[model samples]
Target: MPEAIHIRPDAARPIDVAVGILMRPDGDVLLGQRPAGKPYAGYWEFPGGKVEPGEDIFVALQREFVEELGIEVLSGEPWCCVEHVYEHAHVRLYFYICRAWRGEPQSLEGQAFAWQGAFGVSPLLPATIPLLEWLDRVRYAQPS
Candidate 1:
């Protein structure tokens, strides 16, 4: 069996990461509402940024998380991935499940933060819908 798909050749810059904080203990996690004034603002998303050259992913993710969400992630493990192409940019999102953290989350930027339960939760960012769906599917399998 085959599924529908799209594929394109990589340009000079072919990848970018979607960094995420994965709060566990039964399907709970954080989401941030991007403040009005920037690209993709007013949408909700997991906090992270571009993966730069020569940066180890663990270090890059930690730095990006702190800068974007103001929380110190204690630990994480590789989870899932997604890649999307916008008109001007293309990126491959390497997602991770951040299991632990220090310092209460503060909106270093002006974004609003929420701790969302898996069921009946809506994604803050449209780009994040896929990740949210994936998160729910993974969390829902837990014995409740």
Candidate 2:
């Protein structure tokens, strides 16, 4: 049987996160597995991190890409925003679509990475699933 998870009543306040959907010209997007020892370890998520106090979302996105994936973001367009409440923490994620970047992405944090198509990738972080669905709807929306 699996161990039951516990949540403390006094969990820390919600975190502001900047997330990047690094998209290739071919319409695929990059996803990385969370490193062991972190919350939601092993689950795949868009490459990003917590937004430090007073940091702009764009700057945070660029910094996170370089810090986490070793790539310098050339351009990132604001895509969407979502908030989710987890047992341990609440997070407000600012999602960006990064279509341009320098250097090949390397997993500097020892986490696994993959380029995934529009659908069928499994076991994504709970927060990322809705973003993917939103992307699909926006990408495939019928002409008015």
Candidate 3:
């Protein structure tokens, strides 16, 4: 039989995470598969990571991109915030719209990458679903 672990209410607090919604001029956005062994492994999501203590959201975004994608985020702006509760952790996701970067994104981590249109991808992380809706609204709102 497996041991049952008890978690303190305070210890189950929400994690603060930064996510980058990298958009190309052509309207496609970048999504990366969560690498093996990570929580929600194989699920597609905007690439980003936990905000280290004392780190600003932009700084966290930049650091995460460099570490995970090997690219320097040249320009990014705050987009949206979403909170999601999963079985393992509750997370507050700070999303940024990254339209410019210094290097072509290559998955330095062992994750696959995709450039997808608004409704094209599937099996996205639960937290990512709302962000996709926001993207669709913003992308289509522009004059055609």
Which candidate ranks first by lDDT, i.e. highest?
3
Q: Which candidate number has the best TM-score?
A: 3
- Candidate 3: where is the Cα deviation over 4 Å? 1-12, 140-144
Better of 2 and 3 by lDDT: 3
Query: What lDDT would each prediction earn against the true structure?
Result: 0.72, 0.84, 0.85
TM-score, each model? 0.78, 0.85, 0.86
Please say which candidate is ahead in TM-score: 2 or 3: 3
lDDT per residue for candidate 3 within 1-144, as digits (tens), equals: 999999865467688999998888778889999888988888999999999989998999999999999999987878888888887888889988888899998979889999888556668898888666668876534323
Order candidates by lDDT, high to low: 3, 2, 1
lDDT for each residue of candidate 2 in 30-51, tens digit (9 for 90 to 100): 9999889998898888899999
RMSD in angstroms, candidate 1? 6.0
Model 1 is weakest, by summed lDDT over 10 consecutive residues, at: 118-127
RMSD of 2: 6.9
Q: What would the per-residue lDDT of candidate 1 be over residues 13-131, giving only the tens digit for each residue? A: 65677587667676687777767886676667777878888877767888887897777887777777777776556777777787678777888888787887853334455557766
